[model samples]
Target chain A: MLESYIEQLQRVETLGELNDQVVALRDTLDVEHVVYHSVNSTGEQYAALTYSPEWVQRYLDEDYTRIDPVVQACYRRFHPIDWKRLDWTNKNVRNFHGEAIDSGIGNQGFSVPIRGPSGQFALFTVSGNASDDKWASYTQEHVRDLLLVSHFVNQKALELERGTDQVQTVSLSPRETDALTMLAMSYNRAQAADSLSISEHTLRVYIESARFKLTAMNTTHAVARALSQGLLII
Target chain B: MLRYIYADDLHRFPRLARSMFVDRAKQFHDRLRWDVTLRDDGTERDDYDDANPLYVIWEDTTGGHGGSMRFLPTTGDTMVNDHFLHLTDGVEIKSPFIWECTRFCLAPGAPAQVSAALMLGGMELGLNNHLSHSVGVFDARMVRIYARLGWGPTILGTAGQGRDATSVGLWAFEPELRPRLLSRAGITDEMSRHWYDRSFGALTPTAKPALSA
Candidate 1:
């Protein structure tokens, strides 16, 4: 069932379709809610959630992210976090939790934090009303599936945001390729130059030209782009 | 020196154990800002620590943690299997020949060689135990560190992107790679062997003599 939902998710093209799919996914999983919230590096926020429009609007109008323990905690985490583990000692936090529950946001939650290129931060969450033991068993049984779905959903969201489903290809000269590969292998400029039998100045030229071709911000960015785009095997 | 201490024996080196956990809190919670639980005593520990996992520790001159890493066999509960399966495409890494390594931490003022030395200790653990590979999940920032150590893992899969990218990788333990690791750690083969001998007894005659002094 999860696999079919992921298949349907992959076929979704527009953000609206993605939102509908999220709702359908929540129903299929028999959960109260499933949410995918992304905040890009440019500070643009996007979300596909099963929450009611009124509640979502109220959440935004009240700027709840400033006080949402889930958001605050997930921002610093790189793994799935059980809601029970969060600190709710602060009065404001307690009130926020109370309000969330009152708004039918469920009493149990699991959030997975994802960080993408250029400071893109996103959270994938599942929430439902359940006893603590039941919630623990549910999360344990479905953690892997949730994790897989989260990343793929986020990847699709990023792809749509870029307005391109196609992979971008950039060509590089042999020397440029060699330079990036050496750098990817953690070789310093001097060592790369010595290994390639080229002067350090010449290696720098190759790297600069490659960086320009890839339109990367820096050497590290260039290498990362090259690797991600399949331009460099290493 | 590299000491392979299990939880059962951790009490024997109380100072080293305490310092190791304290440094873990400093690195994972304070420095990295990871959402890890910090005890009131300021130590970062989790369920895995209770599993009696083995720890490879680099004891500094003052008998404190210089650098350390935790290892648990893939056959048991591991960080990769429990938390980061998304990076592995939901495939659990369970094998007798592969162990999981995590919680890599370094003291704030540790020397540059400490990281490499820790890697050397990991290699020693794998080779001594007849394990073929060690699996780990690390962020992109660690890529250069692994490469500089002359032993990079074969990336199984990666998630996210750029600086925040996290990957699950498998590193093969080949006898041929020992010398490069030794040079990178700046430790003589004899010294490495001595440390290994301290943890486990001297290498058997059937085992490769390269690590034997």
Candidate 2:
């Protein structure tokens, strides 16, 4: 069944077709909802969801995005995360949770955070109501499939939004590449500087330069981008 | 010793679970002033608990529960999705390998090391079960605790102030990382002897009897 879903997803060449595939995938999983949301580096956004239109409207009307922990957490992560791990301790958040449950949004959620071309950030999530053990087995059973589907969805979305592949190759100077590689290898600045026979300040310059080139959010982000893009070898 | 407990098996340690619940009522309701509903029995039970969460408990020699925490799969009922979904800006996370940890509690007067011991046990459980991550919403103050314990969790969400300020994060546990974290935290001593085993379901397994020792 998932094989068919993947084939259908691969065949989708447009956003409208992709939305239908997302809904079909959601039904195949037998979950309450499946959502694919993305924000490109340019700040343009797209979303495909199986949530009720009423709840979606309410979410927008209430401006809940500012306080949504899942979105906040996903922004910081580079891998998939479970919703149960997020912090929901505030009173307002607890109230919002109660209202969501009342609105039939399901209580369980898992999201895979995707980092796409040009710093595009996307998330794929599936939510439902089930026992912890049952949910555990279900997610365990389907995580790989879900991950594949997420990437496929993001790739299609990226293609549609950009109208061309945006994976431009980036070039880094030898020093900048070495700095990023050392940082990626878990080397502290002082150690990296010592290894490279450069001052910490010089190392920072290379790192900052590399970060700017990659448009990374920080030094770690810069390192990640370098590694993911094959611009630096560990 | 660190023992895993499930909600169904909670009945086995009636006194201990009840004590922990009362402690939670005091810690969250009274001390933290969290806006959680409390039962007339002075226990704090919520819908998530009803979902049969996996729990890790640390017990001292006097048959008392010293410290404990709760676990739930992200694929099921979790606080972050139902209530704090707004915090994620509508991102939903459902993963089998990621579980949620919550209701971390330490009985009054227990040694500080007990908290670290409880966490170590939880890490062991995840590692043994091949679980990749343990996720939770914690007080912003606990960030220091994670750093001190060398859990090295990635903060997924920024700290937010909503009465009780909290941060969401996940700790990735690889088998190789466990010993490193233990040594970094300087936790060389083994955990206490009593554990409540609920990870395997109703058939409880007790640690080796220690009378000979």
For every candidate, give the share of true A-B contacts it also has. 0.00, 0.00
Candidate 1, DockQ to 2 decimals? 0.02
How do the residues B40-110 of candidate 2 rate in per-residue lDDT, one tens digit apiece? Answer: 99988788777666778876667678888998765445776566645443334444445678888778887
What's the TM for chain B in candidate 1? 0.90
For model 2, report the TM-score of its A chain. Answer: 0.68
Candidate 2 docking classification: incorrect
Error of 1 at A194 (Å): 35
Tens digits of lDDT, candidate 1, B52-99:
678999999889999999987654467886888666544455443467
iRMSD per prediction, in order: 21.2, 16.8
Q: lDDT tens digits, residues A1-234, model 1?
A: 765676587677889988888789787777899999998879998999988788899888999989887877666234356777666667787777777777788888888776554457789999998877788789887765676567667767877898865653567766678889999999999999899886564456457546645545358877987898788876
- Regions of candidate 2 where Cα sits further than 4 Å from its true position: A1-234, B158-163, B181-213
Evaluated on the second chain alone, the candidates' TM-scores are 0.90, 0.82
What TM-score does structure 2 among the candidates reach?
A: 0.46
